[model samples]
Structure formats: C-alpha cells, structure tokens
Target: MDFFELVNRRESVRGYLDKPVEREKIEKIIEAGRVAPSACNAQPWKFVVVNDKAIVSQVARKLYDPLISGINKFALTSPVFIVVVAESRNLASKMGKLVKKKDYTNIDIGGACENICLAATELGLGTCIMGWFKEKGIKNILSIPSNKEVTLVISLGYYEDKEPRKKVRKDIKEIMSYNNY
Candidate 1:
C-alpha cells in the first residue's frame, strides 16, 4: 500500500476478529519499532508482545475506565496487545535532556509506537494505541520491573470491520505554518 494510504487507513481499531495474529507479522511489527530513531541513539524502548489469550484477558481487565462504565470495553474483542515500555536513555541523551530542559524518553517511545502501528497496518493487522490502561496492573501482569514505565498498550489483530472510517482532523491550513506560528 502507498505510505499515505497506509497512514490514512491506520485507525484506532476497537474491534477485531476472533482469529489470532500470526507470529511472523508480530515480529515484523516489533522490528519496525526496533529500527526507530531516538535522541543520541538512546533507543530507550522495549516492546512486550502479549499474544497469549489468557494474558490478553488479564490485560484487558485493566483497560476500562474505573470512573465510568463501558469505556474501553471494545478491548475485550482484541486478540493481542503490544505493551510499549519506556526504558532509560543513554548518558548522552540524559545530558541532552538536562541541558535542553526536555525529557526525550517519552518522545522517543512515541515514535517507536507509531512505527509499530504503521508496520501492523502495512501487514494487514489493525491496532489501537491505548494510554488509558492501568499502568501498575500491566506492569504486574507482564512482570515488568517497577522502574520501567508502561507508556502504552497497543491492541492488535485483524479488524472485525475491514472498512476504513473517515478520519476527522483539523484542516492543513489551520494546523501548519511554514515559517511562523
């Protein structure tokens, strides 16, 4: 698929088929994230792919909004999830962060997460990048170290609905300014 088309087609899929995602495709998705660039070559990201049915359920349990009911309930239909973990940046990146007064770790992780999603879209898998999950619950379920941050959880699988939903967005002219804000 064309890159533009792929980007447009990639949506936060809330529903997925019952079929399992292939392991090869999952690996390819992670490979895309692995090759993503980060500040000072920090590469501060780890992807925990959870394709096991039992674990997927456990993770799903943590996705709903406790303050409300039925929010993120669609996650129950997802067959797989790739948990994006934020790792420590390299010394150079850390110094840069200090000097620039900006933390690049989360920014770097965002790029990697996008890469993972785009790769999945290219390989005929649907994905939803979730930030509304319970981070502590995910850490415990995945055996992730307490120090590591669960930045995002991505639901992945074949879409139950193959049709692409039209994307709503701010107009280009409103969003872009070439030389001035």
Candidate 2:
C-alpha cells in the first residue's frame, strides 16, 4: 500500500486477536523508530518490548483501572507492548530545551513513536498508543531505572476488527492558510 493509504489505515486498534506478532516484524518496527529524526541527534528514547505472554499480562494489569468505567480494558487482549521510555538527551538538545523553554525530547519521541506505528501498519499489524497506563507499576514490573520516565505504552497485535474507522478531521480551509494565519 501507499503512504497515504497506510496512514489512513493506521488507527488505534483496541480489540486484538488471539495471535502473536512475528519477531521479525517487531524488530523491523523498532528499526523504523531507531532511524527516526531527533532534536540535535539526541534520540532520548528507549523502547522496552514486552512480548512474553507472562510479562505482557503483568504489564496489562497496570493499564486496567477500576476507577474508570471503560478505560484500557483492551490492554488485556494485547499480545505485545512497546513501552516508550524517556532517556538522557544530548548536550545540544538540552541547551535547546533550556533556550526554547520547550521539551523537544517528547516531540522527537513522538516522531519515533509514529514511525513505529507506521512500520507496524506496513507489516499488517495493529497498534494503539496509550498514555493512561500506570507508570510506576510498569516501571516496577519491567525493572526500569528510578530516574527514567515511561512516556507511552503502545499495544500491538492483530486486530479483531480488520476495518479502519473513517477519520473525522478538520476541513482544509479551516486548518490551512495561503501564507498567513
């Protein structure tokens, strides 16, 4: 499929099938993220892949919340997860962050994460980028460092629903301008 088609097809897959993603496909997805552009060449990110059934189940527990009526329950059906972690950035990126008063690390990480998702879609796999997971619980379960921060938990597998929902987006006129806003 073409890039536009792939992007259109890449939606947040909530319901996953009872199948596992291939190891090679997972590696390729990570490779796509690894090559993504970063601010001042500082990757400032690490992906902790949880593919082992037992470990994936443990991580899923942290995603479920009884407080929320219907939130993150689909994590239980996910066969894999790629936990995005924030790491130490380079000196130039740090300086830029201080000067610009904006955290470029997260922005760079978002690009990488998107690349991962696109790669997964190309591989005929499904992915959902989740930010509502329990960070501390995930950290403890994965033995992550005390200083490291978990940014996102992306669930991955074959989707139970094969169709991509129609995208609802702003019109071109509302979001675009000729030369000025």
- Which is the leading candidate under TM-score? 2
Task: Provide the global lDDT of candidate 1 against the true structure.
Answer: 0.90
**Candidate 1 at residue 127, lDDT?**
92
TM-score of each: 0.95, 0.96
Q: Please provide, for model 2 over 20-62, each residue's C-alpha lDDT reduced to its tens digit, 9 standing for 90 to 100.
A: 8889999999999999999899999999999999999999999
Best by lDDT: 2
lDDT for each residue of candidate 1 in 1-181, tens digit (9 for 90 to 100): 9999999988998888999999999999999999999999899988899999999999998986656677788899899999889888899999998999999888899999999999999999999998898899999999999988899899999986567888999999998998889
Worst 10 residues of 2 by lDDT: 158-167
State, as a TM-score between 0 and 1, how close model 1 is to the true structure. Answer: 0.95
